[model samples]
Target: MAVHSNKTATLIVMLGALLLSSGCGNLAGHKNVDRGLSYIESHEYEEAAACFDAAEAAGENQRILYRAKGILDKNLGQYDSAVENFLKSLAATSGIPGDMDFDTNYYLADVYIKQEKYDEAVEVYDAILALRKRDKDAYYMRGMARLYSGDHDGATIDFNKAIALAGRNYDLRIMIYKALSSNGYEDEGKAILESCLNNTDPNMTNYEKGQISYYLGNNADAQSYLELARNERDMDKAPVVLLLGQTGEKQGDFNYAISVYKTFLAEDPDHPDIYNQLGLCQTNVGDYEGAVNSFEAGLALGNNEYSKALLMNEITAYEYAGNFAQAKTLMEKYRKAYPDDKDAEREEIFLSSR
Candidate 1:
């Protein structure tokens, strides 16, 4: 699973306005903080860290500074540090709930989720909802936390509330289904998805319909819808191509999947997730070297969400190519980076014998 970054473009813009209005006394500090956030959004973590350091030296607002640091730590998978920094940010707040407060709480909750502290995550979301009573995203996230914590009834109620608030939102519906289906509630998830298919929401785009069809096992319809959606102007092609490749894979056509991924990469080579998918397709076709190259290419794009998966897959590609020595070497590094991964532990044992 990928670590979600909270430094979105919208948030960055909001923060920029917030900092600028704080007066000319801390102008340099504010600019540094803003640049740090921009670097974070671009996945340039080292540059972001430098910018943050400069911001701190220039005496930026303590609350915003801590929150920005927390975001950085979270993106870098330092969950403990993230939690601590987020708490510090909250403590530095002026006892008034504002956008920064909400952002910090959301990021803190996300880090809690990453650490598998579901109850803590729920509490954070609860606080968020107490302030913003009609926040559908908060309800949806709380539902996930409840589901993960085994409070199925609470989860169901929250999910329903979220759905009620987000009328005709196919994306949110599909996300809700994914949360349920991945956590031992497949039948319930299927029912939610079925409702999407049956609803005559005119605002539903081809991509939304395709996503619903894909999850519901209607791959043919998914492919047709996704292909049409891919051609629409101003559409984000990454997701459309990704689903098309996945649909090809579901239909037992690895070559088609590879072709789809490669074509997309030919046009926009910056997407690390696509490279990860392409690498997996190559591995499926016994092109281990190609898989390794693809995975490495993705890893070279800085530490985005797919970095962990890409590194693991690269190690797997080496193993599949009969290069046990290289695989074991990579496994040692992987273990150090992700000591909690039980699967990696087992793989290490297997690789040791090879």
Candidate 2:
């Protein structure tokens, strides 16, 4: 299923400012546009706003300028400001009957998504459908809006419509894969994700491509993509690496799994998830002593409910591995902390019997 409303999202990367020519040179602040963009790139949102404000003040009044401002405000996490600019862009255009309207709606939906205002986003997407019922992006985005807003049935219908229209867009297809995963259709989702790597375009980052492969149980291919897409700031690499470790463990490659997890964890210390993962890895490798210590280290910095489970895990590993003294010590504290857990009562029984 896909979003069957909101006919906006990038139809093509190049059409970011569709139906608008760069020839409108004299209407407003034409000069500072690049400067505004530069400020945005540097993460200096206030400065970026100044540049856009100056252009708007100078009477640029062009939809293109508004689009630029939208991008700037989006980067600043000012969802309200971003939506205002995107709306201006849509309003300024005489009439975007098809793809152009799609682009605006897509960006607008994205802004609403960032704000977690999915109901409003769904309404905006509905408007897009009013213009072009068969628009693929609209259908896809509406599905997402509905999904986030707790309208599972509405979301599914939109997704199905999007798939019916054109399920080939890898970016669009990823939505289907994600929905399947969220709904716990893991095997079906994995198959869908694997099929996505068949086509290649230079613009598609390898890191993103790797994620699809890893999700499909293609560890080698995922690694190949990760190595090729190596960048220090890449948000995907660490997660992919972690996934690789998990894959290795699933395949009984303990040494390699541990190595991968440790290396990834080194770079992401204080990552509670990674710490928890590393502790699990250590336990599997028969390093129960190390497992206890690792979980202890994670517990110091990890203030999540998962930490309690991990502590209990460490206690069980200690008990199973015949570290009776240590198990007794942890069992006492665990019982005190999780008084209602039947498992804690059972652990006390086991300790008493021992």
Candidate 3:
């Protein structure tokens, strides 16, 4: 039940902002920093790390270098390191809030949210809003922090402000609904979604319609809309196909979902998220070996946001295949990489007795 939202889009925009901001400074390490950023975009994390190191050796601007390191650390799930790097980046700033400063603050707040330090996240967002009162993203994110912190009324106020500021942005509406629905405000979330559906604008694409329908529990309608979106040559087919496959799964047709994923992969094989989804469907159908292969294919693509999930699923596939030895082997590596994962710790304990 994954909702296609603006979180990734927001990060992409932040990365672009960092690049643009860094260009303002004349530095010897600009090329290295640029190369590192490109590697990060492609999920070549280790390569990105090396490039960042080279940039540091070449005496990159401390602000840019620390921010780059913060981005990399965040991607690697090294939250504390990311927090430290972001703080260093802030310290290196000229005390003038620019795009880089704003971007760094957003990332810092995001990391705090991930850590469940909602109050800290709220304070960061508060600072942003004080400086740029019209920042809709800050309002929306602050609302999320408030929601997670159990301040439902305050969350609603911020959400309303965000919605008013970005009224035409259907994605923002969907994101708000998702946040509310996931945080025990289902009826309120439903109302927001239903309003979006009722007030359908002509400018809305089939993909947007499909997303709304899916969230509204209209699986059949979601599938039809997604298929239409997929057929449009101008549309990005990956998300359309992904959502369509999810619609199939929602309909209890795992085989259909698997076939959909396979068909898409046969044509466009580079989508890591698609590979992860395909593996999940394979696992559901008891094709543990196929699932492992799918997961491995995704891992080979590189370390994007899906990397941790792919590794964890790969271990689960092996466990389900009655290969506790292989599962334990993988789990040990996973534990080393992500020692903070309580689920992984429990899985390790379970595997030890097997």
Those runs of model 2 whose alpha carbons end farther than 4 Å from true positions after fitting are 1-29, 97-101, 131-134, 167-174, 183-246, 249-354
Query: How accurate locally is residue 309 in candidate 2, as Cα lDDT from 0 to 100?
Result: 72
Question: Candidate 2 lDDT, tens digit per residue, 1-354?
Answer: 232223333222223334443455334555666688776654455687788778866767466677788887675566677787776666556434445556766788788887888886887777767667788878888887887788877877887788778844665667677776787655655665665565555666676686677667677877677667645464556565666666677677877877876786677666655566777888887888877777887777746556677778788778768988888888877765554366688778988788
Best by TM-score: 3
Off by over 4 Å in 1: 1-60, 68-81, 231-235, 300-303, 328-354
Clashing pairs in 3: none
Q: Write the per-residue lDDT of candidate 1 for residues 1-354, one digit (tens) a residue.
A: 333333332232223323332433233347787898888776677898999889887877767887888988887778888877777666555435578778888888888888899987887787777668999999999999999889999999999999999987878888988999899999899899998878757888899889999999999999999999999998999999999999999998999999999999998999999999999999999999999999998999976578779989999999889999999998887776565467888999999988
Worst 10 residues of 1 by lDDT: 8-17
| Candidate with better lDDT, 1 vs 2 | 1
TM-score of 1: 0.77
lDDT of 3 by residue, 1-354 (tens): 232123332333333333323443434447788898887776677898999889887777778888899998887788888887786676555535579878888998898898898987887787778768999999999999999999999999999999989967878988999899888888898898888779878788999999999989999899999989999989989999999999999888999999999999999999999999999999999999999999999999886678889999999999999999999999987876665577888999999999
Q: Candidate 3, 80: how far from true, in Å?
A: 5.4
Q: Model 1, residue 312: displacement in angstroms? A: 2.2
Q: What is residue 223's positional error in candidate 3, in angstroms? A: 1.8
Better of 2 and 3 by TM-score: 3
State the C-alpha lDDT per candidate: 0.83, 0.69, 0.84
Report how far off residue 337 is in candidate 3 (Å).
Answer: 3.8
Measured by C-alpha RMSD in angstroms, how accurate is candidate 1? 6.6
> Among all windows of ten consecutive residues in candidate 2, which has the lowest summed lDDT?
5-14
